[model samples]
Target: MKKKTLLEELRSGTAPPFIRELAGEENMDPADLVDAMLRGEVVVPYNLCRKISRPCAIGAGTRVKVNANIGTSSDYTGIEEELAKLRAAVEAGADTVMDLSTGGPLDRVREAIVAKSPLPVGSVPIYQAAVRAQEEKGSIVDMTAEDMFRAIEDHCASGVDFITVHCGVTTRVLEALKNNPRVADIVSRGGAFLAGWIIHNGEENPLYENFDRLLEIARRYEVTLSLGDGLRPGCIEDASDAAQVAELVELGRLVKRCREAGVQCMVEGPGHVPLHEVEANVR
Candidate 1:
């Protein structure tokens, strides 16, 4: 039998002939299904480097994918333990892995897991930057912007496939945050550090002000950027407040710029959102 193109499936109101044949079945119209598939709104996020056994599309006309986050924190685990969690997550069908490790030997931990991961590995470069800064300089704000960029470069060199950069936390947002009243002010460690650094140094955030440089680095490594939501509401009461929405608006614009530069980007969502507000938060 001849294989049916997407166009052919659209004209009929049933499954494509190929799908029917694959199931050793018949009676399904190929045209309608083919039309649906050819709408061109679907996206499959499989990187050439990631050998996905059951790859799926992510955009319109596909099932929603959920990601599981697992990493070592300063107070609790070690690399070995984190790796065990990583293995378990993959076995449990996590689409990707984000290393939020803030303890022990950072680089060694990241490298070991990256080497072991078959799926795309992601990290918040800011976390490692702060961790190293506290170790060497005793305070995160004491670390220069150059140090942060260097940490980002190192992570890219170490084969991290994607990184979360909080480039939306601009000086303007910091200024607004200073005046905004919220219960969980500055819940994000990276956001708080950048805001304080800007206030203390009287300078703009390096990530926000120097985003082009960040894009260049990402382009060089072919690494995707998960634009971190620095000002994400920490609690339900604070959700969609001016400061949080301000950061999100900025991030949306930045996403366009990143796409234009051929650097793959996705927006990181909020944390601590109440179950009732989850849909609104995502929207």
Candidate 2:
């Protein structure tokens, strides 16, 4: 018999330590949390390989969670500085951290951050793939689907608890974006990377097309997939536009797939929304 996965355990009516910890932290019942997990209402992103010291739950009925992103950029490739930011974010009560390193030794930076981080660590593997493509092939458009998936698997193998995948940035969504142009266009770097690849190669987004393969890796490592919004509004002026809505609709499909696969998943929303539109956006 195969080993039961985290999701399988939850579905079997067993509450794991992570769930118990998160439920206790949130002052909720463990059985109720297990029910939420089974219903795909709660996600506890804990890699079995990585021992988490600060486990926080994200989803319905839980207190709002905070995820702080700290990583090295091309302009500032300082791992120590990023580490300092990580420390500060944790001290200031960040529930999780995402290493969006796009510069310097990408793997080294991620390993260092993940090794030191007590909170769950997440990453955008496409960023590493895009950076590798630029360094080796001279452009983000040169990043192959194999490179993207390889980076994702490597990140999971290295104990990343979660990952942000721009699975909704499809050819159809690009058509929607074209028909209803936004002032900001595309603001997500990973989204833009995949978009460039699709347009240049005339292919479907690999993350969207080969989602089952992605799920296999996520299931093996128990990595939660944060379905990214590639066409999310970069500015208030572009809030609630057709492109953004289209991507959200695509993400909804991905979320359903995730539940069917028994892999934890969450939807990533827009970058900006006006005060008046926040309620609508949440709805």
lDDT of 1 by residue, 194-281 (tens): 8878887888899988899998787766567778888988887888787887898899888777756655677778777778776765
Among all windows of ten consecutive residues in candidate 2, which has the lowest summed lDDT? 274-283
Candidate 2: which stretches are off by over 4 Å? 275-280
lDDT of 1: 0.71
Question: Lowest lDDT 10-mer window, candidate 1?
Answer: 22-31
**In terms of TM-score, which candidate is strongest?**
2
- For residues 47-82, write the lDDT of model 2, one tens digit per residue: 877888887788888999999998998899888998
TM-score of 2: 0.95
lDDT of model 2 at position 25: 83
Whole-model lDDT values for every prediction: 0.71, 0.88
State the displacement of the C-alpha of residue 270, model 1, in Å, after optimal TM-score superposition: 3.6
lDDT of 1 at 216: 79
